[model samples]
Target: MSFQQLVECATHGQTRASYVCHHLLQSGQDGSMRPVNWVRDEDEHVNAWCDECEEYLQSHGAEWNDKTEAFAKIRMICENCFETLKATNPTKELT
Candidate 1:
């Protein structure tokens, strides 16, 4: 079994920790939940974003810089919630 670190989430109780951009945590255009696109980070955390953000990333040569980081409001969520998002929303290949 893959064991991840657990932390107390006010909503999900004790759960694994995961991170994503604030955009992925919010509703997309027209208030619809959109797929979360994962960006390859280190093994310690999950870096996910929405399509627009993904596009912005690619336009910048897939590099994180001041411009990209400007709108990227990262947030922490329970792993359970992350799994829910991963299942409910369509996914894009990790880059």
Candidate 2:
């Protein structure tokens, strides 16, 4: 399964460009959704996350953190999602 497949399955075929963009933005791909001073932070670096990260965050009850302003701007995700997917389905790498 590729990322698109996984997205389709999760979204029940409601996948759209905006949805992809939203997820990508949420996942912090290419630092597209960074804060004003996000790049200035010494520890701030946008790293690409796998499909596991995307799905896992939703499954693990990881909510947005408005206080830190990182969840929305930084595209934070749940690490547990990646761990679970990797442990359960190593081959699929989701589409």
Candidate 3:
């Protein structure tokens, strides 16, 4: 939620912070990942998720709750890696 704390990454070293879905934090790409939702907090990257979680969220009223939160399994990540995931993943149109 907040990026006030910094982390040390082997590849990225110390960098800005972000939160992402567990699936989006995976090591390899299966070409199924996408940037479904993202919010920028001033300069912080905030959070992002994939299409699957987006659909789940929509079905669950598109808000954080007990089940949705448990389903998402979101976790902390570095902005650098977040950028990489965003670049490799496409955006899904919700309509």
Candidate 4:
């Protein structure tokens, strides 16, 4: 689908812009990825990306002293992007 169509489709329900951002961020990780486990309080399952995205970021400017460090960086970067998108598009407030 076109980018606009993707946006339109994603915005049609209770889904928030942050959710969209998360998907986009993870899209680069892999298209066919899925969560391996579920949480009791959350509606959707929590998941991690394949090694591709992690390796991609590591090859770039991202630094990691250990495996946990890499994971922390990934979470920080994703949250930063999500918040930036949210701040710039107040109309698309995530409720």
**Alpha carbon lDDT of each predicted model:** 0.73, 0.31, 0.72, 0.33
Candidate 1 has an lDDT of 0.73
Stretches of candidate 3 off by over 4 Å are 1-3, 27-32, 92-95
Listed in order, each prediction's TM-score against the native is: 0.73, 0.20, 0.76, 0.24
Q: List the residue pairs that clash in candidate 1.
A: none
lDDT of model 4, residue 34: 27
Residue-by-residue lDDT tens digits, candidate 1, 49-71: 87888788889877778888776
Error of 4 at 37 (Å): 13
Selected candidate, larger lDDT, 1 vs 2? 1
Task: Order the candidates by lDDT, highest first.
Answer: 1, 3, 4, 2
Query: By descending TM-score, how would the candidates be arranged?
Result: 3, 1, 4, 2
Task: Give one digit per residue, the lDDT tens place, for model 3 in 1-95.
Answer: 54375767778999777877787776335656556567765655567777678789999998978888788898888888777776777754333
| lDDT leader | 1
Clashing pairs in 2: 1-94, 1-95, 2-94, 2-95, 3-94, 3-95, 4-95, 56-81
On lDDT, the stronger of 3 and 4 is 3
How far out, in Å, is residue 13 in model 3?
A: 1.0
Best by TM-score: 3
lDDT measured at residue 56 in model 2 versus the true structure, 0 to 100: 49
User: What CA RMSD would you report for each candidate?
Assistant: 3.7, 14.9, 3.5, 14.1
- What stretches of model 1 exceed 4 Å from their correct place? 1-7, 28-31
